[model samples]
Target: MTRPETLQASSKPNYSSPDILRQFYQRLFPFRPLFQWLNHGPTPQPDFQNREFAFVLPGGAYIRYQSFLSADLFKKQCVQMTPERFEIGPQYSINPRDRKQLRKASSFRPVMKELVFDIDMTDYDSIRTCCSKAAICNKCWHFIIMAIKVVDTALREDFGFQHILWVYSGRRGAHAWISDKRAREMDDAKRKALAGYLVLAMSGEQGKKISIKRPLHPHVDRSLKVLNPYFQDEVLAEQDPWQSAEQAERLIRLLPDKDLTAALQKKWDSMPGRSSNQKWADIDAVAEAGHLSTLSAKQLVDVKQDIRLEYTYPRLDAEVSKKLNHLLKSPFVIHPGTGRVCVPIDTRHLDSFDPLGVPTVTALLQEIDEWESKSGNMSDEEKAKVQDWQKTSLKPYVEYFRGYVAGLLKEESKGKRSREEVAIEGLNGMEF
Candidate 1:
């Protein structure tokens, strides 16, 4: 397929400073319908210039939309977050190994021309009462952003998806674009089921009795490609053509009922080998034995939530203390490892600051190195005293780095704390 035009050469207006976020919001208000998928609430009032939105994820890491997808034809065609004024969505897709490259090429994809689906809380009008905490509370924005990744993984692993596009709603939540041709023909039931699959919720009905594990209970790794008959061909040009709609319909008819569970199982059976299919059957047996039926396609896939606070700027950083102060004034510490900005209950309003500031790690580290160098040549006892002072003085900096790293690992399966958080915790406990 031909690649889209280069966004860098285009003359689309871009904003690099936070001061312009207000102006951008004004520009975005008129396009509210354009971002209806955000599900934050009634289209934000035009007066939302100074308001902030947190581009967050389920992993607890915020989406960093530094010049996010401006080139996406979808956004451009959608007429909401056009390249002319706003850069809608995260600056880059989640290809972590190329993190540096994405950071360097900071810009939004052209608003995608293709269709997109957004998940948000149905009750956006009552955001304050609804999303009070991190876990129990519901933040549609976070749910939408994070849920898409889970869906993307599912599509690529269970189905055969090579590319997907995403965009921010410029308010709360986001819009994701799937480039796969198969996506267009999906029925409402399948779409809804797909949505539920990605949300990854525990089976509330069964409570402790039900077990909901991710990456699917059977693990689609390696065996997944069998579902795509196109891959079986040894020669590149000899691959089986994608199933026509008529053909797909006929094949689908041969399956059982189209309920979420049945559809999912049908998809598994669509693959080549019955041996791998048995694994899915075994998985179902385990679920049934454990009484985990509540873990249906709806709870895990269908996501309907609202995004509350919209944020702009790079990822969470140490100096963000000053910036987020306007939103919450909590006595907060940013953990570099997780990039989670934690506020002590005593200083909960740390976000009240007008214009937030987030310092880069390089800048923070340089300051620490300078301070250490200046204190060199001192006696061990004197050095110990200085070390104590350093800890007290740089506590915020340490927390910032720790949380930042932690945020990076939000997508990983391991439940372990980030190495930086552990180190900081150890350092925090150390005596002078």
Candidate 2:
């Protein structure tokens, strides 16, 4: 019989060096805190015990149905295997390892997982002018910043969900994991409904006009308010998306009145290289000068408001959030492409969160070596006092993550019923 451990994927990214990966799994990874977060307590429970974990092995092999009884065992396997990365999936009704032994295949199915959102930079490529494709810069990062702020505000205030954690995807985007008991309990249908409510309906080509209807929903109104400040500076000033004539035409197409657009287009055509802010100002300037005859003041206000939303609103990839069993990359894993550790974004100090500044596995490992060299003569007693992870730049991120997980567990304890209790109540309603 072929050993399951020997199974390998035909293709996978092998970015992290084997020795470094082994050390990471051994010393750096916070297995206990992660286990506590998933398990919702210090001791083992169905949340962690029956949860599905899929690993991408270093030899380009993929493995699934991986579960552990405790954090230590999970860490032991990771260190032994030294897989490139692993993904977290929904908790099953039965232990994933034991699913095949069941009499009925249908008896084993996914039950619950954190509701997740994936916001990638590629989604904003059409609107952002600073960087496109796979490249990301601090300037272009404002798009992600805008997306996070808008989505986070809506999730908390509008939907009444707390315990939301925003994590950098380690390359050009971000992911949001909502661990609220209410959020975790949502079925695929409810999840889809919530995602639909969050996602803006801006379909078709880039230049196509977004059909923003009258009398916006309270959520839309509130989101527009959240996005208002960013649109002018981050979008209009920094991006200057409508500076070119071709792009300017795309802008003109979105405007309401023919007289207003004609006047603006002529003005833009005559004076080349006009900045987006100046062009925006020119709209009010021309309208005040009586260029717009047919469009009402009330209608114009509505149009401008819609334009703000069209430009700056969060463009969510709704598919990610509309499922119960979908697997998402675990929060703390190293991104294969960038080699950066996925770190939690502290919403309090959001403006200071820089993706490029995130510590890479290599860099973190080096920091450990440098610290060990400095403390070579320290007594064994003193050396054993502090965890090895605290010695590197990854310290702050891990500390922040552990703290976030603590808050979630505390809230989990306060809830009326445990995760399993609540899940068991509505078993028939949920799709596995």
Candidate 3:
């Protein structure tokens, strides 16, 4: 994939050369930590060798099915190529080494994959008026936060899976990798089922898009609960859909009582320059004055649903969650347009995770330049410290990912029997 062209000349830096990127990959990239994360858990041998990796070169050329026998090998290849961006395949191929044989095989084997979800801002273009395409601001970012919470809660509580890895998309989206054993073991059918279940809004042409029933499913209900605050603050107050006459008319037409709709329209028209929130409040006051009593329970529910359909419901690229072979951008790869590293997100501090705050390659190179200029010669300890990613803002996120993977390893070890124990059991079973 090509880097986005939305980045203006003044906003982007100039250190996008192959040399600077190669130096970053060789000297400063935390390969060891990344390897530990990918090699998580207690199998006889971790599945990194079986996993498929792909790279996107500077001119948008793509490479796929590239596997490494070990972390050292993977590190070596990355250091050698210094790719513009890279992606990790969701599915593990049965034979990563013999790519041609695997492709030609009649019955393919895709043993496991972390259930991945992709949420892009462009999906919300229908609702959001502030930004479009790859552009984003704080107002639009609230949608991402809502998406994470809704999906995270459903996966953890409803599906009974844990160990989710959330990562920034390096551009205009976010990805969630549910690395729990059960999630990874899910077949294509199960993955499709989950994707279908999560989809409330269907995709199609403009007018025929969504169809939701009354008495929302507990999953959607729970998601709406998570979405309530963001909708009120970001969409209703800030976006002010009611500002558009067409949008306001549509909302008014949804009301069950014709008299109430007319009243709301009149009230809305009188307040020519009022804030969207204020206009909405005036309409609510009219409803409360005995006008709302005319509507049935179903109508009231539909009104609330209409509001959600316009603002809070999760807009997902269903194919991302449904497919096993889909490749997602690897974390820590630099986004060529913005030059920012695709960092891992800590959901506990989701509010604090800002895409703008991520370190760009240019910024890191500048830091290195300053460091080299100040100290012509350095001690071993100083050299090590300079190489450590801990000197940057990305340190805490990497450490958080390391701790999560460490927990998975600890869990895996608990179920494992040592070689000595197995040997003793074998000996005891034999007759003299």
Cα RMSD to the true fold for all candidates? 24.0, 7.6, 4.1
Candidate 1 per-residue C-alpha lDDT over 1-432 given as tens digits, one digit per residue, 9 for 90 to 100: 112112242553223222222222232222332332221123332112112223322234443322212223223332332122322221123322244555555542221122244533332222222232221222223233233444455666776754344333222333444434355335445555555543332222112122234343442222233222212221111211112333233222322223433554455456533332243243345344443344553442311010001010011111211111112211122222222222211112221211112232223344556766777777778866543213233354334333432332342213234666788999999999
lDDT against the true structure, each candidate: 0.31, 0.85, 0.73
| Best model number under TM-score | 2
- lDDT by residue (1-432, candidate 2, tens digit) is 111111134443344778878988888988988899889887899999999999998777989999999999999999999888898999999999999899999999888899999999888888778777877888778888888998898899888988898989988889999998889889999999999988887634556667766788888888888888899888898889899988787778788798999999889889998999999999999988888878887888888887888778888889999989898888888887777888889989998788888888888888988998999889989989979899998888889889998998888776735766777878967888
Worst ten-residue run, lDDT, model 3? 202-211
TM-score of each predicted structure versus truth: 0.23, 0.91, 0.86
Going through the candidates in the order shown, the clash numbers are 92, 3, 0
Q: Sorted by TM-score, highest first, which candidate order results?
A: 2, 3, 1
Q: lDDT tens string, model 3, 1-432?
A: 112235678856644567867877876677766665666642313367678889887767898878876777887898788788788884454646575665367555567777899999999886776778888777778788888888889999999877888989877889998877778788888899999988775433233324467677888777777787887898887667667766676566545577677787887677666666776676567767756657764665566565665577778888988877778888788888788878889999997777767788777767766666666587767776665465555567778877878876675455454656888999999999
Candidate 2, position 363, lDDT: 83
User: Between the candidate structures 2 and 3, which one is better when assessed by TM-score?
Assistant: 2
Model 2 stretches with alpha carbons more than 4 Å out: 1-14, 416-432
| Model 2 lDDT, residue 216, Cα | 86
Best prediction by lDDT = 2
What's model 1's lDDT at 215?
47
Which wins on TM-score, candidate 1 or candidate 2? Answer: 2
- When sorted by lDDT, best at the front, the candidate numbers are 2, 3, 1
